[model samples]
Target: MIQLDQVTVRFRIPHERIPTFQEYAIRWLQRRGVRYSNFNALNNLSFSVDQGETVGVIGPNGAGKSTLLKVIAQVIRPTQGRVRLRGRVAPLLELGAGFDYEMTGRENVFLNGAVLGFSRRDMARRLDRIVDFSGIGDFIDAPVRTYSSGMVARLGFAVATDVQPEVLIIDEVLAVGDAHFQQKSAARIRKFRQSGSTILVVSHNPASIKALCNRVLWLERGVIRLVGPVEQVMQQYAPDAPSPFSK
Candidate 1:
């Protein structure tokens, strides 16, 4: 269960890059204020996801899809309006987002569990399962920085989904790793869906969205373009594209 009312997340970016802190300090001392431009990552967004509902978010790059997910995930606070969530959330927003590169994969797993509010003992119980699902094998004891990108994604996805959270927020994570792992991740997602967990997924893959979500929310330029049944929105969103959602 989640709700966002008139949520707006605005960011001020410097007009020009100051390569170093020294340059910035010099500019500051000179009383030459840095110029900034405001960009709205999410503009006046209002939406709700009911418990046990699976919603897919579709949009082009820079269309605020990731921003919307981060807002719901509470990783970024909105500059305006309100966000309300009612459940324990497990977010797989970015590949290896919560990992400590210097730590062993085994160590990072416990760290991530703690971040999600689980104790080390709790993680220990789930350790073997997480490692086995990731298929990282012996590499699980190596530093995370030594892992390949695919390895990192596999471990992260395995840890996040194994929690069986009340709310799951995914952002293009299913596209990572190999096809076998992708299928495994999809199966895990389906299990959560059947267990009545609320899920919000952002993906460019129309087929995955259709297979996993009952509704689709299309966003454009930081605003809602359409929010309705998967087929209804998919038809207008990608009418020329070939997919099962097409008539």
Candidate 2:
């Protein structure tokens, strides 16, 4: 099981995250004006994903869905609150965040695995399987930059899932592959569920969640407005269901 307690994540707008923005500071400079120079990506957000269940996070743009995923994945620590995981979490966030651009995909396999808490021996045993699953061919022997975006994504994904994690976190990056590959990935996720792994998915495509998830949570302006069945949350987030942006 995965749990979050009053999590909060804040990002400074003109900070190291996205390079200093002098113009943004200038724009905010106004007479008798008060503003938030920083942004709160997530605020007191809390939820749980029980093992053997699929939880989908849905929301409009800037609604903190992605931030919540990152927090659960431990890709970025929360500024407040805490997340407790039952076991190692395999986070399939970005295509290359877990890889090394200077190293061959083959070399990166072990590196990424270690970063994910696997031992060298374990990765060695899984190397061939990961390579085969990636379907990247000889390019695995060359630097990752030389590989196509889709290739890197596949390789990274294969490495992340090297061991069946107790918790699995995925974003919409899986949409990069061919239909067959997509199906394969989906099958892999299903297998995880069959084995009793907890799953958390964030996607703009709600149908995937409808097909795979048992539970869903909706976020609006950094707070969870709803959490329940997938079908109901999808209807709540539906475009025609009254835009969350409207007055």
The digit string of per-residue lDDT tens for model 2 on 1-247 reads: 9888998999866433342456456556643223336677888877877779989888889999888888887779999999888987788887556688889988999888888888999989989999888788888899988887778888888888757898888888657567777787778888998999998888877667788889988888899899999887787677454445788
**TM of each candidate vs. truth:** 0.88, 0.82
Give me the displacement of residue 135 in model 2, in angstroms: 1.7
lDDT of 1: 0.89
lDDT, model 2: 0.81
Worst 10 residues of 2 by lDDT: 27-36
Please report, in order, the local distance difference test score of every candidate based on alpha carbons: 0.89, 0.81
In candidate 1, list every pair of residues with a backbone clash.
none
| Cα error of candidate 2 at position 121, Å | 2.4
